[model samples]
Target chain A: PDEGAMAQARELQGRLTKPAGSLGRLEELSIRLAGLARTCPPPPVDPAAVAVFAGDHGVHAQGVTPWPREVTAQMVHNFVTGGAVVNAFARQVGASVTVVDVGVAVELPPSPHLLDRKVREGTRDMTVETAMTRDEAIRAIEVGIEVADRLLDAGAHTLITGDMGIANTTPSAALIAAFTGADPGVVTGLGTGIDSETHHRKVEVIRAALALHRPSPQDPIGVLACVGGLEHAAITGFILRAAARRHPVILDGVIACSAALVAAAIAPESVTAMVAGHLSVEPGAAAALAHLDLSPLLDLGLRLGEGTGAVLALPIVASAVRALHEVATFDTAGVTDA
Target chain B: PDEGAMAQARELQGRLTKPAGSLGRLEELSIRLAGLARTCPPPPVDPAAVAVFAGDHGVHAQGVTPWPREVTAQMVHNFVTGGAVVNAFARQVGASVTVVDVGVAVELPPSPHLLDRKVREGTRDMTVETAMTRDEAIRAIEVGIEVADRLLDAGAHTLITGDMGIANTTPSAALIAAFTGADPGVVTGLGTGIDSETHHRKVEVIRAALALHRPSPQDPIGVLACVGGLEHAAITGFILRAAARRHPVILDGVIACSAALVAAAIAPESVTAMVAGHLSVEPGAAAALAHLDLSPLLDLGLRLGEGTGAVLALPIVASAVRALHEVATFDTAGVTDA
Candidate 1:
């Protein structure tokens, strides 16, 4: 029945008063809406929520990004204070933003916008030990599900997944390599503009971590524990919850993409709600996207790790949904055949 | 004085959040805003007006597009009835759409959204004679100026250029070849999905038109009269008026890009207010963007000519402007620099 609903939505989109298949991803969004709502003209859905998961990685000790771990909490402060780029974009698009401290080391002040769901103060040093235990991974995923349910009950029709973690890309690259069977050298890049020599060192660090853990793909949570940041696990859980609720979810950059890969492994249907916002310049991002068979809308070679790319892309998603709902059909307009 | 303002805007964008040179065309938009408003931070620009210029070409008898000329009127009706994709996108983004009958064969009924500004029923066959007279060209330009002024008075801070003329790509090819000094074979392509054989025929038609009228780039208006649609002339005039009034203008597709070339010829500063929405799939569009030194943001291989791309891109432009106005600097956030 859901498949039939999805097909009807796709047909209705094809019949919209424009060129057939012109809106691209927007067309898919409309079709998804049809299946979700089981109605030709779906009810108006808005009041979106963007959850930005923040964490820290012990890999920072290896000197990958120029910035330190302290900046994660500071940026989280900026996010909560409504001073970040994502905050501005959310305001412009009428979406609310919540910052979740999934694994930051510093303490956060109580605020309505801050969701204190930390799994650990910080991940274990992946270069020496697993980032976290498998049980911790489950806890992080539960954190994501709780966040999604809270936002869903708050009347958010769409969920946009965002993440903020320093040195998170190392774990992302590790997770991507394990999932896609790609070499760490091919999947990893300098996380935050490291020097050439530092980049070489970063690669060696990942190889060593992989050698120590020897994580298997059969257990995605084990792999996440070995290298994945807390935010990634939370995002994976959030995506699963969103898919269970049948709400559209927009994935941000590499960290979120890594989390999504793990989420999809847990529940394959979870990929149905995913929208790749843009192809991040991060090498892991492309690998994650390729593994998932998803295409990003924008490609400006952006490597900024915040939810900036996703925030910039929110309006385009809104346009796609709007196009599906609003454009008149050929029969209604009495136009000739395509 | 305008140049000074443009310089200031560029400088301000340079200091905004994110990398110095990142955001690509969005950075250019900020600079354009600076020049248009003659201020550092451009006015809170919104309430955009998209003028969808509708016209018919006598060259449609040459069989350029698959659709017939009657479709132009029907599409115009769709625009007025809010059934078009551009209409949906505009409504989503809170912009008003006005369809102008620059030169359609059929008379349009009186409608509040339809602008009865037809210079003639249709243009003369450019293969045989000039498409429009110099007097008609001037009147069309004046029509554009009047539309921009009225839109500005109506609290539209941004002016978006759109077109809906059937078989207009023939003239666009001719204009691009004449102005860019490129051979018609290089600038022309099969518009609206013509077969390979029909595409060859369309190229031959363009080559013949160029052979018939040797247009001078120095006299853009004369070149416009020699092979321009009423919609093209009006868009040129509209861009000029928008620039003069310091209203930001977003160029739609190839036709609008061709008109912008003429507008820039008349007033080079007019480029300051121009935002290239996408590098259209049309050969002329890429050539025109290169000639104008403008980089478009969205490039999804779109050739739909109803300003749908531009309307869809408005949210991004709004985000750039909002980012400039909202995002706090490193100093404000008191965060450590990368």
Candidate 2:
């Protein structure tokens, strides 16, 4: 954060037309953007980009979620063809969607918007063994960093975190438990409307995996190698790189937020780059945001993750910037203050 | 709400790619729109209009607020000149602004954007006598009805409620207490950051008005006549008119919510046309929303009135409609449902 720029923003807000602090969080957002952009009137949130990281979770072998692993590859195609809700939302918000094949079991055809950066076919079944090797984890994180570098180089102002993997929230919940020290039952949620039986089994699957790996929070990367999804590692790297570059990143749902936990543990300053877009209906999402001490911009109870919440929040982020840039000050408008 | 259109909307939401109920409140909002539009895919919330109802309160002389009553007329000028926060937000959201002078104490010149509909100079202080006569209150309501009709006839699909009256929340608090039966302190909030002494005095004034009037919630019009600002009266009638015309209405802070409570009390079905824009920092806003059984779309601790919060909500309301109209169904996208 740029202290000088932030101070300038705080001073500028005091001169706006309405009473001091009357705009509430909008005023706070402008100040935060000033620090990130290093400008009092920060740039608009667009041209924004949503990186939909596609991967297959080996835990699909367990019946944690009814969604088939093939759905991961299919959804990546949907994203490429602009057939997904995230695609609709991106168009509405004037954001571009990039599909990154981080780790998929199936072969995918190359496309203009697709980034071929597969670290592995997938991870081993986490309920029975470790998810991925440490080297593979590092490589996945590197892929995320590379994606951020490319997006920012292409003039994208903000990066929205997205993921497409069946049962991804299962690993997300386990990651949240490992990082935040929350009980499994407390943080675990039925990912896609699973029955009570499947939900209970999913909780046990996480407990078993935790017991087998005994992932340590001190070693965030090692913990990722043990229980995190490939997309999770990528998102963690994406968040870290965004912060390292002082760019704003909007986190989508539990998957991105759980990844944020690992990213924050690795570099505490990385959390500064993150913006909680909205509250997902999943329990782990709220717990993760609580641990991060970040308030979401919107809470429509949305749980569909493909960066829909983040894209939906793009206009709001832009509006906060526009308020600072466009609203007349009391001195300029000659409006009396209370 | 149109039951047939709403049923069709529910079926359409199920066909969307995401799992059932995963989109959460967004799906509910689309259904509400369908009911309002009487169509499965309702019209976009665009071509929306915000009615900035400016008025004055007799309680201003009682030092309920530090802002002079003349500021109300000054703000009407500000609204017309596009110098207010509401104008900035309206421009950002692609909405037109209409300033209605329902009861400004000061004389005003005409402008293309300003509507001169002063029912009286201002209402009498409720602590002294009834805030307004029954006939004046009815005329104020008629002004709101006319404004809604004109906006709707001009091709607006949504009407946003905005209030710009100095010390208006005084009447809003009193109206909330009368309708929701909440204690004065529980509902009364410091308007525009009043000093602690004035805050306590504001609470006592509300208590005194409630004791003197003992307004009946069942007789909502009588209650509005007893102690309500002209803007509040206008907004109540605006909401009622919108419901009758099957148009969507986005409500701002306590002033709008307080009027909404009166509107709902008069005709319970009128609540169907209303959308709680955001949770105001004012305590009374929450109690009124709870009593109305409407959850706010955003809760950014906003207390700034003049349609600021409602304009911020336009994109969100539009996104819900776009999802229904634009998102690909699972059958067409070849994506299996969860």
Candidate 3:
């Protein structure tokens, strides 16, 4: 039944007014819609929701970023207060942002936009112990799935997955290394602008975590428990829920891309609904993108996390979909074939 | 006087919430607003207008693109009929598109969105005669300026400059080479998907045009007359008018960028209000961007012209300006210093 929908979606995109194959991934999106909705010209996408998963990493104790872990909680405050770059972008795009406190050590005050989905105060120090337990990982994933369901029920046709975590790149790097089978030294990069010496140290931190975890890709939940941050696990679950619901999800930057790799491992078909917003300058981001066989729509050497990349990319996606839905074909325009 | 406005614009952007340097080009845009409006927090950008200058090149007879000359009129019809990609994007973004017939060999029917401002039916073949007369070039430019004034009076705070001309790359390459001092071989590229052999032929076509015109950048008007297409001259005028009116202008791809280079030569301060949407994979585009000291906000290897890149980028610009106007300051959010 899903295959039939996918086929019908592809046919509908082919019949859109533009030249064959002109709308690019948007054509893929329209086709994906057919499979998901079991209808042609899937109902207009409206009321998009953005889930920004916030967490902190034990690797902060290892001094990966110059910024303190407390800044993570403060930025979460900024997000709730609409002061962060992502808040501005989300507001401009007319998407409501729900910041998930999956694993911040500091407690967040209750607010409409803040979702207290914390599985733990913070992940266990991966340098010494597993970052999370299997149960915690599952709970985080469930949190993500629940958020996706709520957004879907609230009439969000698109769900943009974003993450906010200080020193989170350490876990993300560890996850990328395990999934892509890349060495830690090859996949890890300077997070938040570490010097060459610090960058090397960051890599060692990732390598140490990898050695301690020895995560197997076949055991996705085990992998998250071993090395993934709470935000990573949550994003993975969110992606799955979005896929299962047939809603398109835009992945932002390296951390989100790493989480997406985990989601894909959980459900390969989920990869179909994903659109990479931009290729981050981070080596791990490139590795993750290559592993997923997904090409980013923009490359501006942007390393700023938050959902800024995804928000910047939203208009382009809308353009592609609009092209697929609106441009007249050669026959309709009475233009001769090339 | 313009310098004062620009300084004000910069100050306004600097005051917007989020880190001072976080939003990058968006911060630059907020500053651009001060300069354009000559006031802080430039009034909300509304009634945006995209003027698409359409022309025809005598060089089209030389067989450049797989597309024939008639396709220019046919596509213009598509634009008028709202069947073009730009139409869909503009509609989705809530901007008006004005199709200006600067130089098309065929007569166009009157339409609400169509602006008939032909300098001539078409340009003289640059490989033989100068493409346009100096007087005709001025007239076309005047047409662009008048369009800008009309749009501004109609309450547009932003102007998007687009162009549509067949075999326009011939003139664009020549102009880029003359202005940027780039080698013809390096700056010339296969436009509109011409095969290698035809690509080489197009290069020869540009070289012959350059040899015949021997254009100089010092005399910007003379350069426009020598090899600039009608649409190119018109865009130059449009950009200047936007700057003079303190309105932000979004530049499309290679052809528009090439015209911007000429406009910059005429009035260097004009560049203060211009934002490059994307770098066209067109060889001349990078050189043009470098000469203008402008970095493109997006690069997806898009070579499709017709203001499509600019229209796609509009939302990002809007987001940036909105960020300047909306995002809270560190003090307001009580977030820690970076």
Winner by DockQ: 2
Better of 1 and 3 by DockQ: 1
Model 2, A54-80: lDDT tens digits are 888888888999887888888888888
Q: Judging by TM-score, tell me the better candidate of 1 and 3.
A: 1
Q: Show what share of the native A-B interface contacts model 2 retains.
A: 0.66
Q: Per-residue lDDT for B130-174 in model 1, tens only?
A: 888889888889989988988899889888998888888888888
**A1-338, model 3: which lDDT tens digit per residue?**
27886776676555543335544455665566556555555655546778888998877888777777887888887888778778877766677888889999888888887889888888988989999989999999999999999999988888888888888888988999999999989988766667888888888888888888789999988988999999999999999998888777888888988999999999998987788887776789999999999888777555667778777777676665566567787777887656
Per-residue lDDT over B187-304 for candidate 2, one digit per residue giving the tens place of the 0 to 100 score: 9997788999999999998888888888999888889988899999999989999999988999999999999999999899999999999899999999999999999998887888
Which model scores highest in TM-score?
2
Best by lDDT: 2
Worst 10 residues of 3 chain A by lDDT: A16-25
Q: Candidate 1 — which residues are off by over 4 angstroms?
A: A1-3, A32-45, B1-28
In the range A151-187, model 1's lDDT, one tens digit per residue, is 9999998888888887888889889988888998998
Candidate 3 global CA lDDT score: 0.81
Full ranking by lDDT: 2, 1, 3
